[model samples]
Target: MTDFETLGAFYLGKRYDMPSRARRDDYVLYDAKDLTTHAVIIGMTGSGKTGLGVGLLEEALIDKVPVIAVDPKGDLGNLALRFPALGASDFRPWVDPQQATNAGMTADQFAAQQADLWKNGLAGWGQDGARIQRYHDAADITIYTPGSTAGRPLSLLKAFDAPPAAVRDDAEALQERVNATTTSLLALLGIDADPISSREHILVANLLHHAWREGRSLDLAGLIGGIQSPPFTTVGVMPLDTVFPPKDRMTLAMQLNNLLAAPGFQTWMQGEPLDTATLLYDPNGKPRGSVISIAHLNDAERMFFMTLLLSDILAWVRTQPGTGSLRAILYIDELFGYMPPVTNPPSKVLLLTLLKQARAFGLGVVLATQNPVDLDYRGLSNTGTWFIGRLQTERDKMRVMEGLEGVSGGQPFDKGAMEQTIAGLGKRVFLLHSVHEPAPITFETRWTLSYLAGPMTREQIRSVTALAPAPAPTAALASAPALSTAATGGGFASLDARAAVAPVLPPDVPQYFLPPTRDGALLYNPVVLGLADVSFANAKLGVTEQRRVILMSSVDDGPIALEWDAAERVELEPSALEQRPHDGAAFGALPPVATKARNY
Candidate 1:
């Protein structure tokens, strides 16, 4: 067994360790105590934050700690393959190791051998059942729309009605921290959990009171039924007009329709919340660990929806103390979405409470963002440890420098071997800092490529994420006679039933992988690049699910502005407006992924 019980140094060039590239003395190790602190990892695009993060997770999992990951890009799916690759009986025969390690291997041998790491023993999901199941279980769905008047849904706690499982001892305080979460959520939704003016409170309180009166042993479905109320009488009863500004609700309606079409989601959410081990449904058998993929999500609505689910999970984990004997870790790949004070911030105040207190409750928050500027400073101040990566801006650098000292109590720490902005910008090396480690060190991230290559191309996405074109609703099912949704005594399922959607890509639906065919073709797709989950508003899936619109280039344009309809499609583009004066000032370079098509 490994000597350290918690996080420590990575295998570091130990796999590729060589005096030829740099001296072994240059290596820095991560501190175990930092596991108790908050960590912030920053780096410019492509600076290897993924590699570093995979390394940390691999170590933690090996030590038997369960981790929950928010993999916006699905990059961390490979953490399950960290089984000491170069040992005497392993696959190191392919990896060339200078004259010393190369005696037994070749480059081709290495390439072919590494591919096997992608298997999960089943089929596509890597790492057999252990890693894949962990992710599948943690995956969930959430959907929120901009200017949406629907208000937040009933929280799991309110839906269930049972008082928190009593804390057994002071040592159990960390696990029992769920007691304080309702307040945190209240702060996030800007609703008064107090049952006063927030309007949703009475309903919420009623939902909770119902859970208590109904009985504590009931499952989630029973709880969903207990609080089920008529849509008009429920908070949903508020007139659509009073909730949204105008026709924006139409867009919200359309977006929900899209999610209703995806079969993976249909099969995923069909019955129980516990069957799938999902982030939202949890339908699968509950595994002790999970990883949610948010790569497909790219819009504000989806991003925020995902944030809500994560916050909800933090609350859910509180209810189950013995789900497993090991400590649980929540490693958010790109923490900005959850922690950022951006245009639409989730309950930052409530999230902060979790950040500061959850560690004690067995929830470790790992915030990794390339842009530190977006993180809500008030909440971030709660973090105790930080993984400082290669930052682009001097302001970011300074804020990090100062924040480190403050969090560490001016404890005379080193910013690692590559602390100063200098030559040691290796992909693996990062300026690591923590409250317990006397000095920060420049450490390399673990190389997890044998397992990380997951996202298929656009064609793959279209087929994988797409459904088999759901069959048309029969007269009865279409009327949802069971819901009698419009019926006077309609059930809550009927209320949600009326709003169900069927995905049908319109003629104008754009392709995400297309590029500008003609030069000077500018397509501005309002994309939300995150290291977190993006979800359908009122739908399922988080983490790797993204909300984004791929708008093509405008042939005719003055100075143009972009507007997103509620459905998250590009409702307004430069060409859609009359030409204004054109004075090319300056703009940032576009991400390489954008493709454009000419309009006739």
Candidate 2:
């Protein structure tokens, strides 16, 4: 039996004895680290799968672990709404007036009753106000809408950079990039990727490969241009003209160009590039909880963003140092079409890749689906944990049983008893199965610290994300002087001068500070440089301790702290900073304060 005192073990709920109206305080605890091998949560509609997912996320937040939850149904955005005071006023907006009247109470009364219920229930589970407050303080939640402006909008237009070091060769990396980009573009164009024999696929893939080899990054516009005019005369020894013909290539490119110029599609081009470093960690180097809601997007748009996001995450994973313990989680709430049994959606390939390899890098993937009958269990054999809730159909139950058996790895499964337990499960109840446990157990899910608000509107999402705190500067650069002084000579002047006089940096060098903004603010943009530059600059400036540095972005409403690798690089626009008066301080005369960097 797993020890309850182990780290990451949290109270999930008490065990449920069937056919009894009474309940015992046989508390059931789950070890969060067990999720390193991946987990599955299955149930029918109204079966509390969402509640179970929210509970697990709450546990992760309490443990200070980072999470990236893909919420296709928009319900997970509730992770942002916390009732720290446990007041009814916080619950009133979500309560239905008619439902309250039917229940013989006013809306306010019903809301108060619901609040009390949650409070008492949480108290029973040992999660009182103080403990819940700790969870709130530890978690920094952001709700992102990919194709909507309600939350932080995402731009899927970043350059397809070099592959991770794990990739064997440039040729192999190019092929992977070509495959991913082609699939995404095809999805955008409402076509399927058939790189083997399709003329359009052949033309686009070669164009991407040519641009990549030439160290040229192509956005949507550039891609159209490349297609209109072939970068190379030949494609795989056959003349490009003979294979795709100029007119055919223009026709294909124009189709994509029209899609790009569409008003509804413009949202895809706005906002910062999706950076996993920023998604997973805060400026203070703490783990963050990020909820990406794609419920409002169309099917094609969702697929496009999902493919790119997964590919980016895989690249990020490859950059990390290997670890045996759980480092982060990637949760997909509705895995209906992404990992269906027979259909080969682009996301399925990436999902399977993560399922098989992400564990080695300490990335746990939790997939939840109400439609269990359609899931491809063979691809999910790597999942070791299963949380089974009530299923509506016998077919779904049988499918879940078969999936359980497949993943059991020879462990004995009591199908008949398991079916009975599942069928009898009530709301907020589920069966917990794990290889780490001796046997599967049934338990109720604990109350979530976040209010279970229904799906939020774009305006509501925007309001929540707007209140998020700015990213903090990394510890190494924490005490660095303000961007203005740091760049000119208060401390880093010599280093800046040296860089200016040095030969042009190679494209492979990941760090380079941008020119001073028009307002004269020296923005330490992480998008332009790597962490090593910050470290090198800190050492050159002879700073020893951590200090905070503010990073200003024209695209954001306010300045954010330099969040290490998570900061998105945007085109430096002419700012009011350039119109400000310049200080006449010259080289070789360092201020006394520069010698001692002050901590923020």
Candidate 3:
């Protein structure tokens, strides 16, 4: 027999004897560390898939592992409802009077009886109030609503900003950023992000790449400006006018600008910036349970947020030092179109990348879905554990079996036995097949510490998140240096002032140069001007210099610090040197100049 105690296992319910129709004394256990290979939970709507997910999360919390749960249906908010001292009073609000009457008891009586049942059930599973309290103490929970203010809203407006310290010199990294940003923006605009076919996507990608190389981070407004007056006059061998005419560029910018100015879309611009470090841990160094609820969002909103979030997580994972221990877990409650078999969405690509690479970084992804047929088995093969609950249809069962067989890795699979086990599963019962185990085991899920209150209302969600303390600033933010432009001897002259007295530009010179405004101000760098204002404003806003610098950390820190133009030095405080849009020059104008600047 395997010694679960030594393996740091989570105790599920006892094994079920199919022939005897009874649960055996042998407790089924899942290895906490084995989760590095990832897992999947599959079942029909009423088959208790959510219960199993809650149970898994509870166990992970108990083990002090951080969790990022994507809740599309909003049921996962129940995690905030802790019932350490379960009593009639604790259950009365959740119990229905008519249901109690049907059960031949008053509501209070029924509540009392249910409380006893839960107490005994937890005791049977070797969990007590002390243990449950410990789990709560170890983990902090926050519910995030991406496009709603009901809970903590997530700002996706600056989601496409360049990451701190990512090497711009790396072609692969640059292309990935461009592709992700372009695709995400297109998805937000309700447009398909086919890089090769969509002219809008291509133009956006070109502009993004150009801006990134210039060391500028564009918010929604900045992105719109870039599209309209692109920094580069030529994209490849063709002129910018020939590739995407000024009229077309303005139209594209207007579409995005409209989205930015929309009232409903403003929710995407509020709240804290999504940082993986804060999502995974709190200020006190305790693990956190972050529930990002997208239940109210439409398909386009969900796609946009999910794509950027996953990309951010991937970037963060690359920075972590691999420990080989389970550092974090990502649980997406519904994985339908995000990992479809036939089509590749931006979210799907990032998800697949995580599935393949996150294990090395100690990040485990758990995907649960009612619709198993929609998933890509090839991508799912990367997952090592499968929790198969009851299926409503034969097709779903068959699809799950195929997925199982694919991941079995040539090991003998007893398909008939698996089919029987899956079919015979009762409510809250599941068949757990793990690559770490020699065979599959059937077990009922344990009682959850959090009450299963169904889907929470907006008010309930807000209350839960409000009670939770805000997460500490991310490590990246804490460690990043405040960015400032090198101070010139003249105490920071405005770009306009510098451009006015600058030498006249040659006719053949392409407009749009990178950082450092010279005497003629003819050579303008949007990156230098924008960043200087950003840094100064951030300093005045009480945001730490480090945090402000971290905002622009996506650029390779070394080159940025060493190569910054002295003439465009950043002022810590607001000064006359601050470039203001003078004479209707779009803030931080890029003058046409022929120099060693790289052209997109």
lDDT ranking, best first: 3, 2, 1
Tens-place lDDT per residue, model 3, 332-425, is 9999889999988878888998999899989989999999999999999899999988898999989998999999999999999888888888
Evaluate all candidate structures by whole-model CA lDDT and list the values in order: 0.41, 0.72, 0.73
Of 1 and 2, the candidate ahead on TM-score is: 2
Lowest summed lDDT across 10 adjacent residues in model 2 is found at 498-507
Query: Which residue window of length 10 is worst by lDDT in model 1?
Result: 578-587
Better of 2 and 3 by TM-score: 3
lDDT of 3 at 477: 44
Candidate 2: give the clashing pairs. 478-547, 478-548, 479-547, 518-577, 518-578, 519-576, 519-577, 519-578, 520-577
Off by over 4 Å in 1: 1-21, 25-33, 80-268, 271-289, 298-308, 316-326, 342-344, 412-424, 454-600
Q: Best by lDDT, which number?
A: 3
lDDT over C-alpha atoms for residue 457 of model 1: 32
Ten-residue region with minimum lDDT total, candidate 3:
548-557
Count of clashing residue pairs in every prediction: 55, 9, 13
What is the C-alpha lDDT profile of model 2 across 1-600, one tens digit per residue?
A: 333334577666778776783455677888777888999999888988998898788778778889999999988988888778889998887676777999999999999998998799777766777766877898789887887888877776663544454542456545775787687778778787687888888888787777666665566655665676665888889998899876677668668767766788778766656788888887668888999999998888788888888878877887788888888989999998888899887788888878888888889899999999779999989898999988888899889888888887887888888788878888778888899899888887777777886777777787788888754444323564434432321124343542101111112221123345354333221122212113223677787664334343221112432333454333332232221112222222222322221201
